[model samples]
Target: MKNAKSMSRHRVAIIAGLLLLPGFAFAQQSITVTSWGGAIAAAQQKAMQDPFTAKTGIKVIPEDYDGGLAEIQSQVKTGNVKWDVVNVEAFDALKGCDEGLFEKIGFSKLPPGDDGVPASKDFAKGLMSECGVPTDLYANVLAYDKAKFGANGPKTINDFFDLGKYPGKRALRKAPGVALEWALMADGVAPADLYKTLATPAGLDRAFKKLDTIKPQLVWWTAGAQPPQLLASGEVVMTSVYNGRIYDANVKDKRNFAIVWDGQVQIPEGWVVLKNGKKTAAALDFVRFATGTQPLAAQANIIPYAPPRTSALNNVTGATKSSLPNAGQSGRAVVSNAEFWSDNGDDINKRFSAWLAK
Candidate 1:
């Protein structure tokens, strides 16, 4: 369960081709960076993308897309990959690398972070990978309207399922990613045993059964911007959201939203070079600059997600760090398993899709 005070998280999704890294001429050549087109992308632009361009005198173009693999796969398959660098979810990064859709990045190319921690050692566990370099450490958290629930709001993941007590419509992402894990968690699965339980047919059925309880009252969102809007307009009293969206709303918009980090599922997003792109050199350079200690840390100051590099935490404002999903006071948190999702996602995706169709 998540409160409305702060929200930041990314889920696994998306892909694309590689080419030679071309030289940049300050105002001439540019590499298009693709990411979700919400506050998430805005924060990245403010913290990394724009600054990177300013610092290197390289032009950077931003683009948006729903978190899907079809586009990227098509680009790579057709050998017309347009994106020099792609920001993808962790599981997609793993799947892409496994399918040879991404360039195999090695640790040697990554320099030590500003804090002096080696890139290989600096990133949080499960972040350093073969294809993608971890860029953001986020948590899919629950946020609620304070006025609706008053002082006694839904405080735990279990409470999200207790419709009788909460008495309101709920919002969650339409995809299967963390929705299944949350269902199992609310049904009493321990954090440590979540994947193991979900791996079993009985466990899978149990999760779906739990989700069935909230099906009629559920409102699903397809974009990161929708969750906060749902709560703001009171269409849904409570909704699952990225930690940064709620954080920005609470800080900038002055909304009475609370974020409950309990049962928050942590996810790390990464930037990868498309093997079919023409700018392998420039793409790798951008990835390194963006994921470096200073840039990664700077991104957190503008948003609520924790930085992947431990060193970057030092740069985040106290207010931001305190509300992170992994903070000690934020309650129990679990990292999403990239390998499990990468391997079984296709099958589970179909099942989730079928259930939604029904």
Candidate 2:
């Protein structure tokens, strides 16, 4: 009887050990990705999470935050990091790299080429070093209500200021992300000379003075969706809005909104891995999968935002064409200088906010 009891105890211990094995393995492999909370997040869910789990058997959980880097910094400071991978703006990516918040990625791990995207050092191997990869390219373009403008709507940034001709309410982004660039362009400064002129006090003042001309007529918008809605409701005849949001509103509401890509402010979204996470390897794999051509193409199909991968562009179907910025143009247009924004964004934002408030 004693021998039988001992044998029974040993079998129970074996069963318990087996039960705990899978849990341990699961604990070893889980990645939390952080990104902006909106359509982009939905696109990521459809394109990345479902496919990656099916292929790699790795579970992906997404965490949404308004300002991803700020949240990451808070996490790091408190020593309770929750995110493994983060979707960051290029400027924030640079800032994160400077503060040692990213890891070096291994280029060899990245999948081979994209034909649809322009060739760039923008996507290279290694963590924190080449810390971010361009995921999507969007623009802040002039969107006008076709009914309001009729056949004589604004066609460029210069036209956006001609209240006498294309008269109606106007809207612009509250952020200085592209306001300075647009201001300079409206002031007849060449795109190439925009940054050069903006570096000086006189040039910045000139830009502000140009903005002052339209201040009362301006309807400042803080949300991406606001401009399109304002335009559709006839609150504003023309507004500078994100290309994707405008496209979405146009499709869903059948509003006669058209985007003017000329002199548009291009903004590229970038993906970066977080520095303080337990699942670094898994997070890197997620980044590789998320930015890879296949997944990116899937996202472009559902949204107006274009992937930075050259090959992904070819996958964009006719159904998605209406949302693309410069759809009327033959090829891709120039991308904005993210590095310049990184260096000057804060100062410009502060000044613009103060000016607007005053």
Candidate 3:
């Protein structure tokens, strides 16, 4: 009887020892994620990092890359990729995927879908995969000072070109995506036909010719934050500006800026997993957690950005309602075609740069 009892105890000890082997222990290491540094990073730390660390007992280290894409490209070329997870712009993600700098996502391990967010997926999923999961969906809307436009506000993109009718200092992004689209729209090309026309020589010429009309009125802006400042200081009465900046100026500062959603050019931010990451599984797990409905909604609420998950949108509370784009409007707002931007972004940017220089 004594010998049999001793043998049972010895077997249990051996099993426990095997479970604590070096290989198994090493699998629990923490992961590092890289992302664009700014206000978004603060929101991520609050919504994702703290909660994930508490739940999993794994440390999450967040690093910022000021020039995110350039850093990633440098890492890839040098063959010393340090990023395990990254937040990339939609266009950058597409470019990275094409270059094989990203790993294929595995969707089977993610949480169940809530509202519009996919149930499972990890790798290069946008913040909100449905409604085009936008990390940040900012409209390059026509923002005008209520004081300037007053009772006769510019209602559409057409008004942007009618400077003769509503004259004031005007600003526009010096970049191509929205600027080109706006230029073509001002040329009387329909939104649906804008891209197609730009693809043809005549359409390109037409857009350039139309732009020439307003060129003198234009104050070219390079950064997203510049336009709102231009408006708030009364340097410009009307300009194409990011919706968030306009909202902040209007709501927080009590400025009279307003956004015209018609023909708004939406830009989406995206996320991706790095290729050859050391903690691939853990990094994917983080992605799933960060993009989960509650976390996504929470971040959106705090940051004035849209949650990517459909379920996340449902979780958005009353406090967040006032800040979201088209919050009071009927039906879902129009989102920019990420695939289109991803495909033509480089060529457009180059052309726009040349035009700006001219």
Could you say which candidate leads in TM-score? 1
For residues 269-338, could you state the per-residue lDDT of candidate 3 as single tens digits? 7557777667777777777787677777777776666665567767778465666664653221345556
Q: What local lDDT does model 3 show for residue 208?
A: 76
State each model's CA lDDT, in order: 0.83, 0.73, 0.69
Per-candidate TM-score against the hidden true structure: 0.91, 0.83, 0.77
Report lDDT (Cα) of residue 356, candidate 3.
72
lDDT of 1 by residue, 1-358 (tens): 3543233221111111112223334344578889887777888898889988887766788988877677888888899988878888899999989888899886788878786888778877768789988888788888998988788887888888998888789999998888988999898889999999989999888988999999999999998889989999999978899888899888888999988888899888888888888877777878888988888878787787888888888778757878776667556678999999999999998999899888
The 10 consecutive residues of candidate 1 with the worst lDDT sum are: 10-19
Give the lowest summed-lDDT range of ten residues in model 3: 123-132
Predicted candidate 1, C-alpha RMSD:
12.6
Candidate 2 regions exceeding 4 Å error are 1-30, 114-129, 321-323, 326-334
RMSD of each: 12.6, 4.1, 6.7
Evaluate candidate 2 by giving its C-alpha RMSD to the native, one decimal.
4.1
- What's the true lDDT of residue 341 in model 3? 67
